[model samples]
Target chain A: MRALCWNGVNDLRVETVADPAILNPKDVILKVRLSTTCGSDLHLIDGLIPTMREGDVLGHEFMGEIVDVGREVTKVKRGDRVVVPSFIACGQCWYCQHDLYSLCDTSHPKPELQEPLLGYPTAGIYAYSHAFGGYAGSHAEYVRVPFADTDCFVVPDGLADEDALFISDAAPTGFMGADFCNIQRGDLVAVWGCGGVGLMAQQGAMILGAERVIAIDQYPERLAKAEAFGAIPLDFTKVDVIDALKELTGGRGPDACIDAVGMEAAGTGLQHAYDRVKQALYMETDRGTALRQAMLAVRKGGTLSILGVYGLMDKFPLGLLMNKGVTVRTAQQHGQAYVPRLLEHALRGELTPAALATHRFSLEDSPTGYHMFKHKEDGCVRAVFAP
Target chain B: MNPVQSDNAIKAAARASVTIGRPADELRTLWLDPGTQSRIWTHFAEVNPLDGRTAEWLARGPAGGEYRWRSEAVEVGPDEIRWSSLDGADVPNTGQLIFRPAPGDRGTELHLEVRFDPPGGVIGEAVSKLFHIVPGEIVRHALYKFRALALTGEIPTTDPQPAARKGGADR
Candidate 1:
């Protein structure tokens, strides 16, 4: 079977590899139909995330048809079209029972590898590096999904495959971000970065009753997408983002600020250069431009919803967060908790995430797709691969 | 995979544990069940019952070294089991398991401790920065697998899979 693999830093290739089989009693083999690139995947390709092994498959957000099922799987069987969450979860774990699927205990096969850095391991995710659970990714012709009932959500009738794909990750992640904000009536939400996650977050906030959503980004296409999504777009390159956010919110700051631009934030100042230099030298593990701005642009008592993935960064202004009485909530998305609703939303035409699929490629050309997605070439928000 | 044993053996102590959502009595029953060994400890050492309170153990390292020993149960209770290696065994070892009720109704807190005279020291046994607790770290991971089997009815693994190794496969 042909699959895209990560060979080295900034290196990717589509290769023929062994097809996947059901490895556990609750596992299922999915014949991948659509696998999309994610912003978080860039961390691995750039070598910022060092846990990736050569030949490791490199995709996460995907939807597919179940071709096989292990003995213990009884919920959805072969021929079921489902969207699988990136994170693998055993629904019986205490965390899963509590709807914190990402914190599921029994899913990560190699806990020893991550226990040191994180003190505890989260759920294993498909095609993510070893630190996340080195499961084969969905970029392949077929991928194995463990605890199928817990991780795979059936795509409702009338939801197109392209529309259902982002429900696997981007939509739920953005929904979880808004859910974390605890948004109330008339709340103003400011989201940094107009990439897939950022755009979804704006829509999520609006759905959850936020009166207005402001999206920040430097990319014109993404900003235009945000505008189309009914969010007020703020281009960071043309205006002082912090002041612009303040001015837009009547000098009170946004009621909730979302940093969707994770570790690889595009910034415009000396601080951005400093973070890049420090990160290159391994003195720090993340660039904090977007996060820093979000911290400053949030109201005194607002919620800081961090949907972005982060490792470690220097100069975190904990003092400012504490002094302002801000509540911070962040996690790998608990997609299991939101997928059902997201599917309904997609069916209702409330969520149309397929627009994020600006480019498409065959599984054999996934390397080139990733290249465009990484460089954001041709205004590609996400590069979708059909196997 | 465990490393090959060295002639210059070293004394090592490994301690690991997990908390299962089941009660201590249930866990005790599972621990004492004859099938539990094969169920959770697959691909590691095998324990075979010898007498009523003794078990013969055999372990084969990945690098082709075999180890044999027998352990005699010294102490047993509803919540605890303790054992020690019989004299003159290839590996001198002591193992203890304690099952106590966890706070806030989370379930049983299972504590496992194993001290052994290993044939190889830290460097050869495990190439990890956590070498000081390398064997213990391995034990901790095994304990999680045990937890997985008990909680989810399966042990998670990603082994014998295909990948494009450097200079080996076409892109």
Candidate 2:
């Protein structure tokens, strides 16, 4: 089977590897149809998230057709088109029972490795680093879905593979971000970044009843996409974002602020430079420029929803957050909880993530796809791979 | 009179706690179940319930050997269980498991404390440390595994399986 393997930092190759098979009684094998690049994969490729080994497969957000099912897999069957969430979960776990699927305890096969670093192990994720689970990713010709009855969601009729692929990851992450905000009538929501996740978050906020959603980014194409999604686009390069947000919100700030830009955020001033230097030196794992701005631009006593991935940030404004009575909510996406709702939204034509699929490639051209996605070349929001 | 300090008379202790998202009674039942205990405490080679309040167990020792011990429950309650080794153990040990309600509506806070007298005392402790057999680490791992099992119904491990092997491209 041909799959993309990460050999080292900035090095990705298409290699023939063994095909995936059902490992557990509740597992299913999927012949991948569409797997797309995510902003988080850029972090992996840049060597920010540790514990990645050579020959490790690299992809997470995908949708495919079930090729086989294990003995206990009852909900899905061979020939069923499905979209599995990035985070693997056992439906029976306490966390999963509580809809906190990202924190599922029984998914990460190697809990001992993460217990020391994260205080407790998180749920296993497909094609993430070994620290997460070492589970094979969906970029290959075939991928395994564990706890299939719980994790695999059959795509509804009339939804194409492109529309359903982002629902597996980016859409759910964005919807989860908006859901965390608990938006009320006529509330203004601000989202940082205009990548696929950020754009979805902006749309999610609008769908969740935010009167207006402001999308922030330096990229013209992304900001344009956000505007196309009915969000007010704010280019950080042209204007002072904090002041602009304040003026736009009439001095109270947006009722909720979302940071979709994760560890590799770009910024203008000395603090951004410091963060960059620290990240380069391995002293920190995140550049918190966008996060800091979002924290500052949020209304007092309002919600700050962080969809961005962060490891550690120096000079975090916990004091400011405390004094302002802000509510901070963040997590890796619990896609299992949101997929059903997202599918409904997609079916209703309220959510169309297909536009985010700006480029498509064959499995053999995955390296180039990743290269284009990494450099944001040719206005590529995401490079979708059809295996 | 000062007692002579023997080379084989060293005492070590470890304390670790995890807040499991389950009721105290539920956690206690799971902990007291021998089948669940053996599965969660993977270091235990065997654990046979001798009676309602006692168990004979074989723990994995340094260099792949097994150490035998018999533990009798000293105190048992709805929220806590205390036990100690009876006699004829290679390294005498005593342990207590306690459960308390977490603040708010969270769950139970499971606390564990274990103390053992090393076979060769200070030298035994040093040798165990050299062999990467720190008692504190062992207790910590057990406590974590216990929490995971109680909350997730299984201890998570990343050991490769046949279906998910990380094979080279050349293969």
Candidate 3:
């Protein structure tokens, strides 16, 4: 099978790799129907996630059909369409019980309690990471998912792969981000970053009954999409965002803010990628300028939610926050928690997260798909790979 | 030997700690009122109930998120106010409120230290490191709520109400 392999630091290539087979008695092998790039996957290609090795297959968000299932796998079987959870988790763990399956104790080898990663230790889903269990990703013809009973969700018969694909990551991430933010009806919410996940967050807020949803970004195309979603769009390049937002909110800033930009943000200019990568790998910290902006913009006595991947070591401001009377909430999207709910919404046409699927490519052209996605080419919010 | 200078020193120390390392922020400074404490812990129909739903809602975006904290007035001498996440993760997150009183100064400096076990493994560490970027902001925001409680003896509710400190003051 051909997988999208990380060739290392700013390099990615689609190459022929070994086809995955059913592993554990509980594992299932899927013949991938659709897979897509996550903003976080750019971290691997940019080498910001230096922990990944060359030839590491890189994709986490995907949906496909089970071609084979292990003896114990019951929730899904051959020919069943399913959404694969980004992480493989042991159903029995302190973290799993509370829907923190991403933190499942049996997911990783050696059980390093301090670092946050996803999936099984030796095997996660296709090409995401090695440290979090380097399982080959779904940007290939075939991929394996462990703990199949709990991790794979059967896609209802009528849903297309394109529509259900995001159930694997982005859709759930957006829903989870919104759920974590706790936005209520008639609330004024602001979302930073208008990429795929950002757009979904905007839609999520709308579904959650936010009266005023404002999306901020530098890209005109993204801002346009945000506007279409009935959100007030703020282009950081054109105006003083804080002043504009205060004006819009009648002197109080937004009630809540979500930083979807994470550390890959571009403001004055894209930080030297090499420098960013070095800090991410060596310093064990992140340069969180976007997060800082989200903090500053949120209203006093408001909330700031972070869903962007901060996969680096960096200083976090505390005193400035102390003066603001703010609350910050965040988490890695527990894909399992929101998939069913969001899927139901999608089925009802009340939400269409699949609208972000602006581009598509076959498994063979995945590198091009990745390039288009990383550079934001052709108004691309996300790219999907069809096998 | 001016009292103001000593008070300024502790404030400066707290400010400096917010930037450089985790230890300084972990130290405690001020006290929180019981009503504000209840607002964060018990969901009293305030602006932020400080509950798990608040955290989830906040993640969706500002308009969507809400949060509440479970707090207690602890007897620990070094730390006066203690709080924990009502919705616990793998590693329980606890906050310590420390007060630093400078000689001859009546005002105290506040510090909040938040600690949690990282999720996943080495990958989880890398991911957690990224997540650390925003937690500081969240903690700082909580401090502001604490300050409002301390000054007004009231937890800011979504609906306007009287300030406990002013005994019927309205804003």
Candidate 4:
């Protein structure tokens, strides 16, 4: 089977790997029909995510057909169309019962399990690197989804893979971020970062009844995407982000602010992680500028939800955060909880997450897909592989 | 594809807790027994009514065996619950479940602590860091599971032991 993988930092390759199979009673094996590179994958290729290892299959966002299922998988059987949830959860775990499946006890597959579990190699995902979860990703010809009955949502017969793929990760992640930010009808929401997740966050806010959605990013293509999604786009490189957000909010900060930029925001890549290690750590001014800016942009007592993965960062301004009394909610999207609802919306044509997918590649050309997405070459916001 | 493990080795790994300042081999002798082991699995496997379809899956044991039945009662103090696993699999990772009862109007508090013990040498250090957990986070999972089960009184899903089938070995 042919699959796209990252051999190491900055080294992505398309290689032949063994085909996946149903090794557990609760597993479902999907023949990869459509899969895409997440913005986090760019972090992996740029050497931003230090824990990514060699031969890491680099995809997590996908929607495919269930070509096979384990004896225990009754919810989804062979020939069923489903959007596999990215979070690998044992259906029985406590967190999973609460719909916090990403934090499931089984996310960490024990090294001792003699039989292969379902899902990719990492914690329980299709194609994220080892740092997140070593699940074999969906970039291959076939990918296994663990806890298939609980996590994978069967796509409606009419839904296209292109339309449903982002339901696996981006759409729900975006929605979860919005939910954390407490989006309300007629609320003024500001979203920083116009990447795939950011765009979905904007849409999520709109779906939740926010009257005005202001999206901030430097890239014109991304900003344009925000505009297409009915959001007000602010080019941070051209104008002051705070001033623009304030202007939109009538001198008050936005009712809710989302930092989709995460730790990937240029200089302060390590601040969130480092700040946790030490108290009152001093940071270079530009490193956590976006985070600080987010604090200023969110109204007093309003919420700031961070949906990005922090690789590591220099310093954090705890003082300012404390003084504002602003609530902060951050999470790696509990994809299991979001996929089913998001897929319903996609099937209804109420949301279109794959609108951000601007480039396509064959499994053999996945490295080029990664390169283009990383460099934002050819205006690529998201790229997919047709295996 | 499955191979059998020696009884002694399985016993050693079950009781291991690096944070408790004990060697892996000594964990079994100190904190675990069949009764306590079943309690943890039953607690983890119980269901919640608010959880719809998945709740049914939780109540039903896996073909290997679901977390089917168990009874736990605090014997010595509010925190110490003597438990037994009837049909489901036992908690294999660690066996020490500490419970602290409520002093006033607050309900009884239970703490199920599983301290991870890494393999020997530098490799252990790396594993420990990768699987970092605050004491609160550990207690939170245990108490939350217990609460869910106590309130719902049934396992949530039909298949409590969902296995990672294909890619479990790739890592």
Top-scoring candidate (TM-score): 1
Q: For candidate 3, write residues B1-171 as lDDT tens digits.
A: 767655533322211111111122232322332334434322111333334222211112233433333333333565355555444443334556566553332234566665433333323233224333334434454554454334323332211111111222112
DockQ of 1: 0.47
lDDT of 1 by residue, A10-36 (tens): 888888887776678898999999999
Model 1 alpha-carbon miss at residue B25, Å:
2.0
Give the lDDT ranking, best first. 1, 2, 3, 4
Candidate 3: what lDDT? 0.63
Candidate 3's C-alpha runs over 4 A off are A110-126, A264-287, B1-171
| TM-score winner between candidates 2 and 3 | 2
Clashing residue pairs, backbone N/CA/C < 3 A, model 1: none
TM-score of chain A of each: 0.95, 0.95, 0.90, 0.89
DockQ for all models: 0.47, 0.27, 0.01, 0.05
List ranges where model 4 is wrong by over 4 Å: A48-50, A110-123, A265-287, B1-171
Best by lDDT: 1
Predicted complex 2: CAPRI docking category = acceptable
Q: Per-residue error at B18 for model 1, in Å?
A: 2.0
Off by over 4 Å in 1: A264-286, B1-11, B39-54, B60-63, B118-133, B166-171
Rank by TM-score (best first): 1, 2, 4, 3
Stretches of candidate 2 exceeding 4 Å from the true structure: A264-287, B1-11, B19-38, B43-110, B113-117, B122-134, B143-154, B161-171
Better-scoring candidate (TM-score), 1 or 2: 1
Candidate 3 chain A: 10-residue stretch with minimal lDDT = A110-119
